[model samples]
Target: MKRVIARCLIMVVTLLLISGCNTIRGAGEDIERGGEAIQRSAGG
Candidate 1:
């Protein structure tokens, strides 16, 4: 489960990096939103 989550996060980060965040703060927010989505999907 941990590995799966880690992989998902890595994929999200990679995709976001490729997508162009424009700034570190924007990237962080994007990542946080992505994480929240993941948590919600996981029923957290």
Candidate 2:
């Protein structure tokens, strides 16, 4: 019973970390795209 609980806790933490990483990457991409749009408008 103790082993099962430990395994579940580890799995939940791992999943949370993975999700956080994805969110950060997505935010970075959005910022980069916004900068490019600004430059394009200024140049044209």
Candidate 3:
């Protein structure tokens, strides 16, 4: 029972970390795209 609880906790933490990383990565991509769009508009 103790082992099961430990495993669950580890799984939850891992998932949270993964999700946080993904969110940051997604935000970075959005910013990059916005910059590109602005550059294109300015160039044209």
Best by lDDT: 1
lDDT tens digits, residues 16-36, model 1? 786788888988998999999
Model 3 TM-score relative to the real fold: 0.50
Better of 2 and 3 by TM-score: 3
Location of the lowest summed lDDT over 10 successive residues in candidate 2 = 16-25
Give the per-residue lDDT of model 3 (tens digit) for 1-44: 99999999999999976775578778688778889999999995
State model 3's lDDT: 0.85
- Relative to the true structure, candidate 1 has a C-alpha RMSD (angstroms) of 9.0
lDDT of 2 by residue, 1-44 (tens): 99999999999999986775588778688778889999999995
Candidate closer to the true structure by TM-score (higher is better), 1 or 3: 1
Best by TM-score: 1
Candidate 3 error regions (>4 Å): 23-44
